[model samples]
Target chain A: MSRRARAGVESRIDAPAGDGAPGGSGPGWPPWACRLAGVAIVVHLSALLAGVMGVAPASPLERAAMEWFGPYHAFFDLGYSYRFYIEPPPTPVAVATLHFDDGRPDETVRLPAREIRGPRMRHQRELALAHSLFVDARQAKEQTGDISQSRLARSYADRICQIRPGCEMVVWRVVQHLIPDRDQVRDALDSPGAGRFDLFDDSLFATPEWIGDFPCHGR
Target chain B: MPRPLIEIRRYLAELSVSTRAGWNRFFFAPADPTALGLIRAAVGLLAFWSLLVMGLDLDAYLGSGGWESAELAWSSLRPFAWSFWFLVGDAWLRPAWIGCLVVLLFFTLGIFSRTTSVLSWMIVVSTVRRAPAALFGFDQIVSMLLLYLAATGASGQAFALDRYWRRWREAKRTIRAIPARYRKDGLGRAVEPDTPGLPAATVSANLALRLIQIHLVMIYAIAGLAKLQGVSWWNGEAVWRMMATGEFVMFDFTPLARWPMALSALTHGSLALELVYPALIWPRLTRPIMLTGVACLHVGIAVVNPGLSEFALVMIAANLAFVPGLYVRRLAIAHEQPAVRVLFDGACPRCRGWMALLTAADPCHVLAAVDLTAVDVRTVHPALTEAGCLKAMHAVTASGRVTAGFDALRAILLRLPLFWPVALLGYFPGVAWAGRIGYNRYAASRPRDVPCTDSVCGIHSRTSPPAARDRSRSHAPNNATAIQEDS
Candidate 1:
């Protein structure tokens, strides 16, 4: 055989670290490259596929990575990049009201969703938590006919106190008909009078300590 | 009547082989070292800059009493228990930050390329995790780039001080190995020449570049698909919404109300380019165009949108992989080293075609071609006469060595590291005989239109007069072409 052909056979036999089988990456290509690339392609594609197949394997990992890394998860995981925004039809808007009993200015602290801070993912986490708390409060009102004694109401009221010092009363409420008319201009979407208060179920949370002789405490 | 089933089976086998060959080429082709070197330096600098930026408010960011207190940082982590900050106390924060910076500096310099690359990537992840609230586009991309960079070896190919240090080591070793030879500097003491080693291209670098390329595709594909689901992207209100948002508004785009179409196109065009990127970037012909378009897209985003912040810059930096290593090598090395201008018969389509690929594939664009078909080859080359042009393919090196035929091919291949092995094989007697026979065959198989094409011109065929025209010598030049494929 020609020397060139002989060297080819030798290179194949040796199969050095950078040199794979014949016709592997070019003669100069790293030997470990093809397999590494293959593994990566297979793993990344499988993650993407599982993400598509309703996340049998990837979903758990995706959720874990998200909780761990938040916005940084996209660096480690592969699913959330293509996730679309499908929020439940806006329920008036979930708002948290903080009522101070030590009597300061009448302050209504809107749910954390409205006040976005830092990265979008952080804001997203805040919204998701607020929505969960809002849902739990509604379920409690449906069950007990009152939100003041609800566990979520008390815990959430405590958090509000932590977030804002010396706060006494906190109430969570939803204004019905939050999505504006199709024909309405963009500027009108956030207008104060755009939606009506669901007075009967609007009060989602309040401080449990001061049920007061105050008439508005339960309402 | 042909055997249809048997023929179909044969065709499928051929197709399978062809595809396998292509797959091998894609995954294993000896990657250009210059390209990897370029990517390494670029990625390293970005890492250095990023890591340095991370330390700007390190004490405040990771300190016990700053914006993110230790308690808040730990609680924010929840069940995911991983962080550099959690392990290190407040007193060690500055020291840790400094250590991270030193490692990043070494990484960027390619001192201990892969080791420092991994260390830097770890630091990036640790720092990012410590302050999730502070994370943005730049932080995410830097981490991703570092992860990919860690997978490859010898990212510091060209323009790295590591090359100088490596050569100094190699030179010292050579001086020691050669006890009899007196090597010295101007002081006349034994020493190695300061010339650095040729950009040491490696397979690892190729694989790394490919990985980055693949990862970029996935990012674009996912991002494009996600945008497709958004109502604003479809309604053309996406740009308007972006403009209206206080968080994203960089340049004053309020005038977009009057030129709504321009605003809509800007938003929609970005999505359109991203959707097409993964699909079109695979084909070689479209690869450059797609890479260029995406690069511009990022530049536009950086200029007009700027919301992704470091995301745009990091992506543009990553896209450097597609810039073609041969071209980069040509830019970096062609000036520092000797180059040869080639003289070829441009009338030969096969020759011109190979020349085009060689030119395109050449990492160092040092090969200047002067077509003998149109002009007097001597006028441009100065050394070569018309007889030399007819003798074989020739090139005049910068030192003005007029090389011809297989030797000429060897000289060109010598300059390209990928083709150096092919050139070395030509030195073997058996290979040399086969190659000469092959070159003569192609040279003899003229299209039969040239003036005085026979007689002395076809001296190799003079042994077996004209009727058969050296049928046995036919595949020789093909081997020669194969030899130069690395170039």
Candidate 2:
């Protein structure tokens, strides 16, 4: 036989100790060690099988525990508005007209021709009168030309544009006689701008006397 | 009819020898010792890397927010709790970076390999336990294997600082033992006495190897049985399910899945194979078939599974058990020598008895004995005198040198299966002196005419010598005398 083949035969005949004939004792282990090893192997295999089957309770418990220890509400997605401007139109000089609208407390007013700095002009009479009446009755005495209703609306729109670039204006006609610098007009402007905007649908606006009761008036 | 039986016996002997030789050549013939060394180096590097990684954030893997954070049913004993404390004290409590430095030293040096293994295992286990949410089977297998290596004392062998230290100690001992006369010699003497060598540690090593082989077989048998016992595995659907899972879906099992019914049948057959593997190892006819099936199964597992390379390697090692012994001896002779010729008696009863004893002693060593009276000794060895053959046992060494009597026995012992232990005994101080005295005593006790029945003398007596038998009987001491001598 070839040398290689002959050597293979020798190794087989001289099989390593413990690797004796079949049914013979294996290595250093006795029957008991084999039994113990067998049991351990079985248990480990069972556990592995259970894990593979997703039947292991440890998996779920582990996930729950992880979630509990991790940061709370750390990964969820909140959606409020920034008020930009407020404007009051200048007074119109036709019949010294006074227009009262529904207004509430904390209402801000802007005048196109004047700059009222801080509290010096806080709650000023002219701005308040212009905001409440839409046309200032005191301005009629100082006017040298007739002021049409269309001209009053145009002046309001122009003042809104100067103070707040994107502001819109709507005009409302009232049956009451025009009043100049009245306390009622001051009260109407000082209340708040809850339902004072005439651009809103009629159902959305409240009467001037009822403006103080509107929910939107609170700060 | 008698001739055929003799032929059968001869064929069986030859077959046994050939098979063993084939296996030995296949395994050890091309072995690159360097490959084993490289494997050791790789493992060491891996250990060092793991140690470095563990040191970077030891605390992150410990305490309430760490591995201990996860509450496992089996974690109540809290085996890793001590390991965590060690890490914490070493890393956070100690001044500077002593903890990592110490771990790195242990890993690199492989000192206290078992302890390092235990510590590393605990840390890895604790980490895995803590982050059971992670899906890394490779890490788990690596950790477990590392733990096994540590527990099993694999580091005792190679590529460790331990081995280097042992070698250094051995070298120092050798140097110390050198004779002063030899050391002081101005020039090498034309003829110098043979230097005695250190005792071979082969026997103890072989013992350890045997234990490992046994353990390896147990693992295989148990693993096979376990797989066979599972209903899902028996039905083959377990494999299918494993393949179907997202984590295991890397393999394209679509084609196999298409024929689940056929695949399930194949699985059942596999289960049967595994369950019967232990039984198959015994029967000569079935051994080859079973071994082939096992090899294929392991190969299939390797292909279909991740982190099964170690398992495959171990299984292949275990398969070496199937080899026989006579063939191994023949290969050892062919590669290292021509053939071992043993001269023995055919008619002498005592000679036959000794032959049986030697046969059992050196199961792996190739041997052939011829009756000195029946054959011409010169054909095999032209130098062997008939008078020398008749006087004592003789063996020719691998170098074509003749050794006789006790020396011949020692040489034969060296070549035997698992004979390293006995062979190593020959290297002890004054062992040769003792052996020479023993052989002399034994040779002196031999009967001149007839082989004695008692243990005191004679190897064999001629079969048809009635007068010699009568003389032997008369020479035999009475029962009373024998008893008195024993006393």
Candidate 3:
């Protein structure tokens, strides 16, 4: 026979039976196909069950309904609502107490107090947002004593203007040249009148001693 | 007399019966006992190698994302579908693994042989699909063959585990009950031999084979024609330029660049050889020469460009299909001839002078001069005339046939080891025609000092009328001069 004709016959003979059959003849379908189909069904069903369980409700009436028919049902409803607010303390106090060793040169600068407002006050507002606030080296030491803690807190309200264009000592760093006497600074901070001012604690700032100390606490 | 004849008749009857039985066992048996064994061995080896290459951690390769990773694994199922089932069962693994496994099983077990074939085909298809960049020509060819095999029920008969099970079932049925059609005395009957015709399964396998064969021929013909379509191929510089590229150069040809002109000519010649290759297979006269030329080209490619070795091997293998069995026998016959022999027109001064130079150059002393003028022209070659010899060079063999001009040159080169290089020149584009024209010119311009003495020259003189001979003689010298100038 011609090769093409023979090939045609061979192709027909080789073709798998049930290729066109729907639901295929049972005997011809291998057992594995059925097994795979079963596995797929199980996986899909379990995923569906998990999805239903995740969206179920948790109130008394809803819980009761869920308990009775939770397996069959996909969702449950519950009802309630709540509200409230918190207020800031009045006359917030902020002490400025200077702690320096004996015979150390005191570097302090004093200026008339000023009010800061409007969009320009954002810098001070951002500074206040941080737990530890800093001030220029001159002003920190000058205002260290005899400053009411509550009035010191008001200084923050317009303190941003002190750093603005019209303000004196706009940019500064506290540079205390102190002798090495840790006990003296501790005694000054513990004194009864120390609460009146904001403290210029050089030990709290990053310094050689602070680095040696490793961890420091501020009050 | 009755006793001797009777014994002889009995002996002859027994011999005939035994011979018939032997034929039945060897050629017409219902089952190929070794077929299953071969299938199993092939499948097992394929599987073992695949698994070993995979290192039993098929996940990594399958996850790497391409068909090559799972090719060995999938090929194991090329005979049946058992591997495909195993793959489907492990669906949570990477799809490549699953796909490969599915293909393997389908190929192994021959279950829903066609469907599994298709499924395995799809898996292989997906592999090629997912990473076409990694696909090699061999991989594509294998995939195509696999799909064709799957569609054609390659494992339909004795070459499968399915067939074994079928045989086992049939054996069981035979043992359990004696069918009324075959039972004679309420006793179990021997099983009947299968009818003599093409088995459905065999038919399927043959179909796949036929498709492969057809595809192979088309690839060759198309590839050859495509090469011919290019000018570089016609000019013979295609090979040189192709090899000059960095990607193809595994070995440096830098020193050879000074002779780029020669290299370019060789390239153009090679391309032309390839272009006309398909045509050469058609004519019996050219088949051997063309096939040899193709083989040499492939061998050259394999040596110079190892990266193309696979292509060369496949093309060489495919070329074998064009070679008829008779040609192979002819080659075997040709090999018995002597290494070198000189053929010349003894009557022609120019031809004899060239032959003398060729003979003197034979350091190995292998040359044997054969004069066409001295031989019995009719007895030597019934197909050729004496006039034919006068027109061109002729080489006669023991079984004589006039090999003229280019063909004579080819035959001489075929016998000589050193001059084989010149035979390769015949494969060059347009060289054969040029050689023919050159030879005719040389033959026509024979010097007057060489006189014709016999009927051989008489035939040439008679064949051409006086006026035509005069005109040819006048123009022949100019043609010879032109040929020499062109060369």
**TM-score on alpha carbons, each prediction:** 0.54, 0.33, 0.29
Q: Give lDDT tens digits, candidate 1, residues B1-487.
A: 4799889999999889766665655556565555556666666676666656556656545665443456655665534345677788878988988888888888777778768888877887777667654555566667767877775654765545566466555545543333244222111112333342344445566666776776677778766776776777887666565544332334654444556577668778878888899877765567678878888877765555454545666788787766655465544455644387777654343454445434433433457666554455667667777556755678788887887777788777776554657889998879877887787577655331122343433433323234332431332233223222422
In candidate 2 chain A, where is summed lDDT lowest over 10 consecutive residues? A76-85
In model 3, which runs have C-alpha deviations exceeding 4 angstroms? A1-219, B1-95, B98-116, B154-210, B229-231, B242-244, B249-304, B308-487
Instruction: Quote the positional error of residue B59 for candidate 3 in Å.
Output: 10
Please give the ranking of all candidate structures by TM-score, highest first, separated by commas: 1, 2, 3
Listed per model in order, the count of residue pairs whose N, CA or C atoms clash below 3 Å is: 22, 35, 39
All candidates: DockQ = 0.06, 0.01, 0.01
Instruction: Report the C-alpha lDDT of model 3 over A91-204, residue by residue, as the tens digit.
Output: 111222222233333322221111223221121222222212122212334666422222222232223322232332212221222221223434554677654212223442
| TM-score for the A chain of candidate 1 | 0.43
For candidate 1, what is the DockQ? Answer: 0.06
DockQ winner = 1
Residue B268 CA displacement from its true place in model 1, Å: 3.2
Which ranges in model 1 have alpha carbons more than 4 Å from their true place? A1-37, A48-219, B1-16, B63-81, B171-197, B305-307, B330-487
Positional deviation of residue B256's Cα in model 2 after best superposition, in angstroms: 3.5
